[model samples]
Target: MYAELFRLDGRVALVTGGSRGIGLACAEALGEAGARIAISARSRDEGEKAVRHLAGKGIEALYLPADISSESAAQAVVKQAAAELGGLDILVNNAGIARHGDSLDVKPETWDEVINTNLTGLFWCCRAAIETMVAAGRGSIVNIGSISGYISNLPQNQVAYNASKAGVHMLTKSLAGEFAKNNIRINAVAPGYIETAMTQGGLDDPEWSKIWLGMTPLGRTGKPSEVAAAVLYLASDAASYVTGSVLTIDGGYTIH
Candidate 1:
């Protein structure tokens, strides 16, 4: 019974930025649960590699090369995924970029790039997915957010990233309220410091690693699979009654 609740048989899922990091992990988890997977990334090489990885696990998957920051690309990826996979049942807005610098010194282009990719692009993906889901009368969206949306991180200056994720948190709520009547659910997962390629530079720095571990009650950084598991629950029937919620997988970092 428990397993059945999490099974995604006959469902189709699209995961953006799925070539690596948390996105790839989410795709793998959803595929393992029996969902057909479509992964989109800016790099064709990375996308193909991700597809190969999923295939090695005996999961049916497709690679869609796309830059989600472009509205046309975002819409096209969703349309192609739906056409190829039969339909869209789940959407994971996991593509994001972060730039760290003093707000006073940050370039306009840097800020624009981060906000556009992290927030605006995600909205486009959600909007496009909603059209199909609403027609079908059922769908689920699990956005990958950051605990930075909740609390400012020490020693790192990422005002743009924090602000963008905060936008995502609210966007999830607003969309959920509007789409609930259509049998569509929108939610987000706010993960703390995870060991991913994006954070490898910081993690490799002894001082940064020590500071992060000290702040986290778990005493270590989180793994991509850990975050992926939370995403899986939200994407599956297990969360039928859940919506407009932000599940924090932060290893007790916000306790203070």
Candidate 2:
């Protein structure tokens, strides 16, 4: 009975930015749980590779190349995924970008890029997925947030990223309230510094790595699989009672 609680037998899940890192890990976890997977990414090479990887695991998966920063693309991706996967039972808005610099000196274009992709794009995906899920009367939407949303970082200045994630957290709660009656659950996962392609540069930097390790009580960076596990729990029936909540997977980084 406990094992059956986590099974995703007939579910279809769409994971944006699923080519690598945390997004890819989430896809793998969902697939392992028996869900048909649809992965979206901006790079065809990466997307195809992810598809192949999932196939090797005996999981049926599709790769959709899309830039979620554009509303049209976001909508199209969802449509394609639903069409190909049979239906959309779960949506993971995990696509995001970060721009670091002094808040006063950040460029307008950079700020817009960060906000558009991190917050606005996520909204578009959620909106499209929810529309379908509402009609079906059941669905789960998980947005990838950051620990930065709740606390400022010391070695990096990423005001836009932080603000965008905070927006996601609130958006998750608001949507949860609006969709609960429809049997759709909305939630966000706030992950701390994780080992991903996006954060490779920072992790390789002696100074930055030192600061991050010193600040995190775990004294080490997190892995994509760790975050993915939390996402799996939230996306599965195991978390049927969970919604409008932010699950922090930061190794106690935000405790201080």
Clashes per candidate, residues 3 or more apart or on different chains? 0, 0
Tell me how many residue pairs clash in candidate 2: 0
- Tell me the spans in candidate 1 whose CA falls farther than 4 Å from its real position: none
Cα lDDT over the full model 2:
0.94
lDDT of 2 by residue, 1-256 (tens): 9889899999999999999999999999999999999999999999999998888888778899999999999999998999887899999999999888999998899998999999999999999999999999999999999998899898999899999999999999999999999999999999999999888999999999999889999989999999999999999999999999999999899999
Candidate 1 local lDDT, 1-256, one digit each (tens): 8889999999999999999999999999999999999999998998999999999999878999999888898898998999998999999999999999999999999999999999999999999999999999999999999999899888788999999999999999999999999999999999999989988888998888888889999898999999999999999999999999999999999988
**Which of the numbered candidates is closest to the native, going by highest lDDT?**
1
TM-score of each: 0.99, 0.98
lDDT of each: 0.94, 0.94
